[model samples]
Target: MSDAPTTTESNPYLRDPDVQLMLRAKAGDDAAFSELVANYQSRLVSILSNLVYSQETAEDLAQDVFMRIYRSKNGYQPTAKFSTWMFRIANNLASNARRSAGRRKEVQMAGGDSSGVQTGNAGEYLVKEKSALMPARQLDKSEMQGIVLSAMEGLNERQKMAVLLHKFEDMSYADIAETMELTVPAVKSLLTRARENLRTQLESYFK
Candidate 1:
């Protein structure tokens, strides 16, 4: 789907082909389930990897996501877009894993291409790079990634997840709210606070 924002006249969720494919899977089409898994595997792993911070764990969690979906196919419903539903499941699973493990120490973000980076196209990086107060030496990609990832780690889990869904997925506020089990206003508030926290944390990089 085009990431471009379009009019809501057409309910994008209902219009998504993946939703139809999921419905087919719900109807006991094993091949449809395989196709759904194929279509989402990489994307799911990418998103989960950032959340969980381990490609190996992300792959395992993604497999678990598919397993859950497959097991509950009989009760599948289309209340939201297939991707949103899938991601909601992913978010919950990640949150549970984090909570279960307890007190995770902060780690530097690594791995993944720019496309999978949750920070969004280099907009924030450009702003920092062009700042008058920036150090004379240009920040390389690794430095930028470190700074961005550090700032992201400063956010609360919900704030971080909200930023990820908003920036990486290009999801509408409504869709994000649906995926995160939040109200539209709550999503907006979460993002506002998240951006403020990031800006504060990254202040040294800016003017």
Candidate 2:
């Protein structure tokens, strides 16, 4: 009997449709590549915008991510889900950008738009349990969104990234650990600390 594992056993992530698409792209299927880009472009931009706090910079970084993916297509492997692999690339790029730019100033969430990043359910995700503590005066959507954005901005970089992945992407701790190149326990710790920080910030609003 052969000692080598079967293909599916060796790379279970190959079962993912996106991973199939990526494999097709690696085989020089341009349409498959375009589909991957179309599917993930906005999502990448949204995540990067939250990380860098600039729509323009996020869009630019997203393009760079795709370009790197294209350049490395021949070397692509299906050991992880496509999104996990892509976000791992994004995490590294965002870290590099942050380091190159030094300290970043906080930007307020603009009116009429949440700065091109959807705050979808983030408020609920962060503070649903504390809803009863809120003041009797109901907060409008924009006001609550601003509060959430400020709380997100208050998190340190890794914590912010971990929270975004957990809430926005619905990634589990193991997936988050793979994306961020951290151990699962470390990812859990980051999220635990992030939730506490967010709770503290939200409590101030409730007060």
* Residue 133 lDDT in candidate 1: 38
For residues 1-207, what per-residue lDDT tens digits would candidate 2 score against the true structure?
A: 113232876767767899889889989998999999999998999888777766667888999999999888887877778999999999998898876554221233232322323222334433542354445464575567657877888889999999988888999999999999999999989999999999988997777
Q: TM-score per candidate, in order?
A: 0.73, 0.78
1-207: candidate 1 lDDT, tens digit per residue: 233233434555557788778779878889998999999998888777666655666788899899998888877655668888899999998888776444232222343223221222234433543463356475575577657876887888899888988887888999899999999999999999999999898888877
Name the lDDT of candidate 2.
0.79
Best by lDDT: 2
